[model samples]
Target chain A: MAFEQLAKDVPAYRAPGQQLGARMRMFERDKDELRKLGVPIETVELASETKHYRLASRNFYLPRLGFDAREGTARPPSKSAEGNRPPEVTFSVEEYEMILRAAARAQDLGHPSIARDAVAAVQKLSFDLPIIDPESTEWIVPTPAAGDSVILAVLDDALQRHKTVRLTYRSNEHGVVSRRDVSPYGLLMLRGRWFLVALDNRASAVRHFRVSRISRAVVSVRNAQRADFDVPSDFDIRDLSEERRAWELGDGRPISSVVEFDFSDAVAARGAELGERLTSGRASSRRFAVRRPESFVRWLLAFAGAARPISPHAIVSAWRAAAKDAYANYASADRGES
Target chain B: MTKRSADSASDQLNRVLIALAWLSDGQPHRLRDLATRVQVDERRLRSDLLAIASRTDDESLGALVGSRLSLDDRTVQLHLSLFRRPMALSPRESSAIELGLALIQHEWPRAEAAVAQSVRRRVSRLTTSPVTSSSNAPIHAIAEGMTEVARQSLQALRGALKTSRKARLQYQSFSATSASARTVHPFGLVLVRGMWYLVAHCERVRALRIFRLDRMVSVRVLASPSAKRGDEELRATLERGRAIVKGATERLRVRYSRKVAPWIREDFDVLEQEDGSVVVEHPLRDDAWALRHVMAYGPDALVIEPTRIRDEVACRFKAIARPRPRAAKRRSS
Candidate 1:
């Protein structure tokens, strides 16, 4: 009845004359008890001679204490007695400086997301601490390069809107920038570098672009609807990067194409770079099937004439014709110079 | 001081202070209101706030009075700066720091000094005696197996969660005879009864499933990822699975011996009661495995309803427990 009366304002209410002071005292006692239990009870004297009393919020009530540790103690320390003594040990200036250094180093050198979180956590710790030297630590994270900022922003926008993007990308060998529209799919960090996986519009295939090489990126207005491509549930990212060569294509359909390499050449020493696809059969011969033939041929030709195509007649013929054309072009250039 | 105790106190103090800072940002809080917000008694909360307020060079208790908290009426209003911070835990910032130091002290003595000293300095201002130690001994034991590779994987998982991106995980399942690749849009990692599980949408099954990390061979953050599962779909999947596995039944009834009655009563809801016996309404699928499970208990368990299940159990028992004549006796006699 007391709580109900306190809930709302009543017009021209008359209180019973008997024991009015006693009831008010009882209310004050209840308020005291509530305060001890961490309940925020407020009392407001209205202009119309009415008193408003209620809890500030539902959460103002503290949770009940289940177990008391002091109950089992044979001799609990007196609160006043324990408060008189100084802390057992105090941190020295040097020690305090070390903590600041460690925290700052962690805050600066760690990943941006992690560093920001750590700083907030440490700041909370500092609130309880008596002394801290924030400036003592020289740990500073380098600001991200301009190129990284551009790439990250574009990737972020594309992901948010689920839109394709057009990028001006320069190839590593050609160094020629070409505009390509791609369906922005995912971003990966491999070997401390970032790569963007997107559906390449020109090739009509999924291709990976190193974010560092991308000079410009623009979110395309056009939405290309394609069959929903689901990433396989069990795909592992570390396996893709941890292998001898980074396979950006993910778990693609297994393709078999034969390649022959001369075992007598220096190219044999570079077997580790060839990865798991190449197999050494005879002492003088190495037979291998390229999993990704397009990417593997450029890697194989780095060995010069030592690496030869064994099968896939078209690849062998193409390599042979390229070699002959290169020889004739060089001979003609020499005659012109003479 | 034991490194573990120091670190634990520091962690507790940090969480408490963060909570306080969030509450103190908007308005001044009355003693009682502040205590309620911080979930401590007025006296203890006053001491803690004084301790914190004393450390700061700018703010004082007077500033609190000028803003939202008023002692005259005992009303407190809170500011809204409490929800802006991002929360993360690292090895150094984790509760395991002290345990890691203690364990590493025995094997890697050289590194122990730095770890122990660091913990000591950080927690010097807090109360010296350990608050709770024995309760966390088991937690330390578990942290022993967290290797660098596992830590890296956990970090990557956290990053992927923040970005809301799908992760390509190379998972090896013990149930699977061989390792298979999978792409998963990871939802969250839950620690249930000491085991870690990643609840995510499995691309292959196109359904939400939980994968035990202990059974996970490796985890990777893929470059190409998919969107996270929507909230409605996730909730519906979990509800459906729970209903099938543990939903209440309306018609099924079973009788149990007095010895097994208590166990049955505790396990299932009771439908009816009679002299020295009770009938329970248990929802179960009509399957071979369910019939076999009912028969395993023998005479201790009996089916009271659904004549088909009772006949099935009896037939299954006869097929397994029947006596057989020896071939030798027939030939020699």
Candidate 2:
């Protein structure tokens, strides 16, 4: 019973005196036995009064027990003999290699990671099959670097602890630098770039931070408990980053705006799909609730006279002011040219 | 030799036909033996070869023969060119292939290093004339390497449906230390999103398993055959495997602020509604992993269901958030 308890209760490593009486003696004996088999063990003090024992390195073990005869014979009867015979065909190794090589090449060409994964997968299949030369299969393109090991480690710790982190981050826009304490939530990849969604301590709101821009990370003592928040099922990382629109502003409130477009502006609708909508109209004019108006305004301007923003007077005012500034600059440039 | 050429064209054809028959039948016929059997000298046989080559003016056949043959001596030797066949591609397939090749040639450094010569050869084969007809250039858009491989594997897997042979595979697993050999009865390959996966029965595990082919190290046709798998059984295995691997259904209850309440309601089903907050219930299998995931949201997400998960989260939070020992502080001082 003592041995059973030790087997069930004890971790892979235990410090001397950590276990009391019989359990301690058993641990010592086990350690000596493991040492005889060339296992390295280390003891470290975790706290002032407590010492913890652990394996100094990874250990590989094989079970001494063998399978029973009955278990060996327990396989179900052959069903192939009773089933209909399948057709016989063979693929040449060169042909299989060609397919794998094509896949690897496609990935090297800036295809998405999934495409590269597919190539790796097919290469593996070719390795198992008689049709492909294994030496010929290689990952043609290098995998994108997500970040340093330290960044991943910090992210893991932050994720596990539910604690906010303070970091000095540099922004890509004008090389601006700022210090922020944020509640780390989700780390995701968009178009080969890694981004972290965290609740900013200063603003007390959710913000997305690029992982590459983080210069240093310091764990905070404050426990930031997660509210009842779930990442929307329809939320796609690619859709959010691919196009900058008004809805991506991460603003606190959702704004309702109306806009009109001609048939030529149908391509602009694709950009609108990325934003949030409160009440949508399917005709030439559409109404949408957006978080970021800047993106929507920019998108509207791209169509020139083909599209116009009608509702949400604030957004219209901003657009009009921006248009006036642009016209003034163009007039100045034209006069300078004359 | 001159007299043999002067003979009827039909006679020359007959001798050529007989030689072709002998080659196909796998019958051993020495050049000396064949010359005597055909009632002609070695020189006379050479002239018949010249006649056969001259009579066959078909360019396709000529090109086929040109690729296969190498002339060394006056003595003629027939090269079996028919056995080597190139894969036929539709226009769409060819475009896809060209796009993949161009991407590798331009983007992948390792690919450029490894198959530089092959890429050059393929490029030479493509028509150099500018594409004036179509607005979208075929070479401009290329799928990723893995996506291309997945597409090709899916095609092969589809084709494998006709052939009932069991595939012998060497598969490398991310979690495992090394690759292991297994015999899998090929059922079908499924594409979920952009990744390609094979659903087959693992002989080693004696169970059905889903294998990501990219992780496959080597594949070969096994001599030890397998029977056809039932569609119902395959479907059941896939469902069960998916449930075991991905289906994590656990009941979670949490109290969220009214501000965060609507967001939760939009994402998950609410188990109960209260005055200031709402209790949200969700199912997950990996409770520890799920708890860690939920905790990442900070104070925005609170665990109220499954007392163990809640306790675990609180305990972990306290352990990490707790300050360093006084002794350690004193040592630093």
Candidate 3:
């Protein structure tokens, strides 16, 4: 019953079930709500008992979008035209093109629902113009693989419905497959993959599950109208996904681990607290509180001979064991073990 | 009510308003077609229309002030002058479009920023939702966090691409000790794994090079037009994954131990071994990438074949495991 018809003069209401006073009160309530939504609506009384409703200001509607030809150009204004002109609402073609391009780029970021919404918004904005296909091959974005898409679709539905999702997940450390029921909270796309931040029902802990590693997903359908759980206010998806390093993703206690980088690779470890600066002419060392020794060892191994783990005996021993195991694999293959 | 249900209720309201505005244009519209445009089923649309018509006075609400819905079997006619235009932009739509514009604005030129600002201001006025910055503040923070140098360089490169011209850049490569000047023809920009890279035909290398935008020290668009275009080639290269070097790619086979096999299978097509390990054949342009990849997983990932890569990784492992005299000095010191 909102914004139905507005004219200069409207006769008093006569037909209906509700009394005139009750209907007028409801109409007043609706008018207040519309005004709160930024609609500049005004009512004028033409007769003692009759009233007319109409949109009061032109600003209540979206202005016509046009390209400003004089964009980025400056000219000396005459005295007559200096202060008498009203501000014009217009956009440049460059701005429109940039918005269109960015919208296309965002659609490629791998979140299915956001991608759909982005395209829909683009369509609405460019309703008058020819539609630029967001799904075209011209835009090169790293799209999720087919397997990822299916998992994402399931997770998206679960999160939107606030349902518990049972996932058959493969752990990264041990390649172990296990089924767990979790309340899906939020999703984040980073490093070309989607990660679901959810609360594990069994563990009673919030955890990050990589969508790709989930082999199966079943969204709870019991009591479909009700939510299975509510996400805690303290659980922020950004804080959980902020861990950029592989070792930082672990939930265990942090262990102080020191790594020595050679003179050539010291630049790679520049951001960390430098124990021995590059100017020392020897190896530069830095310290890190590693939560997962296994992941840290693997990350250190990537540096090869240029970096060595110089830490609590456990870290060095783990690194050595990993290096020896890696060496043995190739050595065994060399001896026709394959 | 729960937040999800509340969101759905609000979403329904937006849909109804949009549908009403769409139908307000004095023409007969098919009920099914209107439902499709509003992203709702026909049954839901019919119910919504009935609900609106049921709670109306003689002069307002459903149909029109004077004439009510003239419902035929196929089409419904709405006689109303009000809401003849599309409804104001909803809150969520405004936020999404604002974020989209902010993305390019971070790397846009000064003149372009002015235009973007004007667009944002106009968009801000069009939204019926109360202006709340809290919902989208973090995303805008991330967009604005780009360094001034990178933003300027990106802006210059974008200008070059737009004009189909060459650009000169002082870029620092990962392997290089210092920045070097190079002229290149910009083909396109690719965002891979949250990092932006420019795929360009580097004049110095006489081939296409993927340059990280952040690695650029300075960039200037050249006036000369770059007649060559490589959109298809760039697409093919990116389709193969983030290729740093433009050349023939070699297929390198590596085996992931049982411990990481399940995780490895998530991203790659691999052959499962009887021992529960998985052998994944990955493409690479150089041995350096192979070395880093195999070494990154340590014992979990092992180079299976291509004796040269396997030997190189083995040699690196041996060197890392060997006790260094300098390492002993660190503990003593």
Which number leads on TM-score? 3
For model 1, how does the per-residue alpha-carbon lDDT over B186-245 read when each residue is reduced to its tens digit? Answer: 776543222345667788877676565645557777766656556554443233112122
A1-338 per-residue lDDT for model 3 (tens digits):
12234311233433346575765665666565555344555665665555666664364544334345575333221111013343234455555566666666556655554555454455344422223333222334555655766777788667755789999998765567899899987765545666677788898876767778898999998987566876665655545433256565535577987778765553354334323344433346777777677778777787666677777899999999889888887788778886
Say which candidate scores most in DockQ: 3
**Model 3 regions more than 4 Å off:** A1-95, A127-138, A157-163, A201-205, A219-243, A250-253, A266-283, B1-83, B88-149, B214-217, B241-250, B262-276, B324-333
* lDDT by residue for model 1 (A151-200), tens: 75576456434567789886533345789887665554432345676678
Residue-level lDDT of model 2, residues B1-333, one tens digit each, is: 001212433334334433333233233446665454444576656665554555343343444344433333433345653321111121223333444454334333343334544543442232122212211122123223343333344444444544666777777663343568888887665433223467777888777776776666666665555566656654543331131232346666665544455445434557555564567665554464455444433344556668787665555444323436879999999
TM-score of chain B of each: 0.43, 0.38, 0.68
All predictions: root-mean-square deviation over Cα?
Answer: 31.1, 31.5, 9.2
lDDT of 3 by residue, B1-333 (tens): 001111233345455555665667657889887765655568876777776776565444652522556665667667665654444554445655665565556556555577677777776765654322223222211223345688788778777877889999999776455789999988877766556788888898788888888789899999999757656677665744464453555788998888887777656778999999999888666576578788989878888668798888999898767766887879999
Ranking by DockQ: 3, 2, 1
State the lDDT at A85 in candidate 2.
30
Cα deviation in Å at residue A64, candidate 2?
A: 18
DockQ of 3: 0.25
TM-score of 2: 0.32
How well does candidate 3 score on lDDT at residue A209?
77
